[model samples]
Target: MAKLSLCGGRAAVTAGSRLLASGLGAVAGGERYTNNFFLYDCSSAEKKLPDHKDEDGLAMAVGSDTILAHAFSSSGSFFALTDDNKRLILFRTVPSWQCLSVRSVARRCTALVITTAEDRIFVADKSGDVYSFSVTDPQGEARLELGHLSMLLHLAVSPDDQYIITADRDEKVRVSLLAAPHNIVSFCLGHTEFVSQLLVLPWAPDLLVSSSGDQTIKLWEYVTGREVQSCDLSTSHRQDGDEDKQRFAVSRIAASCSGSHIAVLFDCVPTVHVFQFDAASRQLLPGQEISLEHGVWDVAFDASSGLWILQEDKDEVVLIYRLADGKWQRSLNEESMERLSNHLRDNWTLMEGCSDTESPFRNLYKASYDNMAHYLQKKEERILEQKQKKRKGAQQETTQQTKVLHPVTPSS
Candidate 1:
């Protein structure tokens, strides 16, 4: 393997007969890699979910079909996919590929989330309704609804699945207790414009992050919903004047599972900005910024693989970047890419086929509440039984040791 260090990271290239046979084993050990000079056909990468459509003659547009939002469940077995239409779709990975679940939300689902316990999927809709669906049930169940005065733009579920924090078009952020049914714990109010995104740090229950159209990202204490740190994207660019201000729109945001790093995708800039936050000082320091050709629509970090998935809007390409070396690669084949593009076009037409009075129902599924609760209860019981068995084995060993040795017992 030939290893080279460049631009704040190191890159290792595998040299082997296999590499020669494949031209480049871009896919290796579950991580994909590509250099700055190379571009691969990423059209074949599996479509995780079907296209979401709207009936109002405003079916979710194409170039905008770029996953505007995404969320990984606590178990990571499932993920929620939301497109620019803000419609929500649930995807579960089968042995071969990811498949859609029965539960789907109709409103423009801007954000998707799963409770930490993996029992429920929390969907924040543009219509201001936060819908909760039970994941365990075959029939999607709707639990409680949190109605916002304005459009519910974003949502983040805590690792414990006890709390759900939401951002709305009203520029207000609210935290509600998921377990307690309809309890509004607190509200974070400060942003002057629509709150675009919300991210909860994996390890920190108290730390919640929000990005707003006000051109800033704010970090808050989950318990209090109090703003602890704030950073202005407007200051990121050195250029002055209204042009710079107009250029800055914080589109998508993500926090590394470790809580050490944050990635912010801006609409105006072609580069993704990384920031490191100091918990002690509550300050955000600029980290490395990686530039790409197309504007970034969404960014997701796979902590297990240490890979970053960046979806670009213009070319409709999903770029995979290795965190260790900053090597960028594209997934999917040219044929698959064309298929996806065509699929999007076909989906638009299908969406257009729906009349204004008709509801859009192509990719959406709904599951029921009682079935979800029963499934979770059964799952917990099984886990507890396994734990009890392990404990019994340990006790048996201790009891045998405590038994007294009686050499003469046979004689008696």
Candidate 2:
């Protein structure tokens, strides 16, 4: 297997493969060049935004029906994507992404991680259960491991395989012994809301970084339950004005493989903020912000060369950007994503339609407040019409009474 050198600080490199934007494996290990290709606007932030082919200037689109979760192995030899329908597809990433096996879980899988040893794969689901399976297991039998009380939002294993770190929606980061997951080491509790993403730096095993719905990111040493640092970045707000700005939360975060750069992003947002990570001091410095062409769902970047960005509006789920002159720039052309590809779940249809009684949204009210306002508006209009009618009728009656009282006996 050929390895891509991700270390020159910021040097020009070459591309071994045209990045396939739909898969996560390519950017995880693919060789990219910093040749300053004219295809994409390099450092578009430094100047005015330029008009590109696609709206928001995105290169390509991956039009999968629905993709729930995706991840690449530690060695970058394998990649997997979990469909919204609970089917998990594994791919061999070395020569090319070849479909290895497919397994369907009972619930929607939220996160996946391959062990540092690269022998096992673990997947966490929204139902709070974590399952482990062999990497090469064609059967794809997911064995049950420890479980959480709330929905498992993220998963991470220590470099030495001593502890398994799991973040839950209940704002708790639990550290459990992998060998006996039932024996939890400690709970890193600081976030006020749901925990969304988790990362333990490869070079610094004791340090852990986590992002959460409380619109903040925190660094912790899980074994000792110590909070090292925290940053408030929850700026993305709901445009509808129905929800609070902090509700957007810090959902997705990626650190460069070299561990020098950390990127943070949010769901339904087109902007990304990069932070410089000082490995020695274990502190994160705010860096430049990159605006994308469309709303993005997730983002991942290599420490040295490339970033895998997933967009929501475009058909291409994954977009590649290469590091150039200390700044990450979009390099891979849009044509690379033009060719339509079939994923493992390409033939599967999103299961839809349900009886009113069985619908999960059955109890959901359609903003009865808004409806009540409309109702009151109509009621006021009706009342005004009735008042006008009564006034007209009273006028006619008064005129008739006057005539009767007058006893008009003349010309009329």
Residues 1-412 of candidate 1 have per-residue lDDT tens digits of 1001111111111111000001121343354333212111112223454565667756465433334345555544555554443334454532212445534455656667777787778777768887777767635656557888777767887777777788887778889887664798998888877777788875565788888767788888867877888888776654445454443446567666564777777654567788877777866777777777654434555443232433333245334454465433444453323332343333332223112221111112122269888999999999999999999999998777777553335555
Residue-level lDDT tens digits of model 2 in 307-345: 656453324534667667777777655432222112212
Q: Which stretches of candidate 1 lie over 4 Å from their true place?
A: 1-70, 82-89, 98-100, 104-106, 237-244, 304-412
Per-model clash counts, in order, read 22, 7
RMSD of each: 27.6, 14.0
Q: What is each predicted model's overall lDDT from 0 to 1?
A: 0.55, 0.62
Best by TM-score: 2
- Model 2 — which ten-residue stretch has the worst lDDT? 10-19
True-structure RMSD for candidate 2: 14.0
The local lDDT score (0 to 100) that residue 204 gets in candidate 1 is: 61
Candidate 2: C-alpha lDDT: 0.62
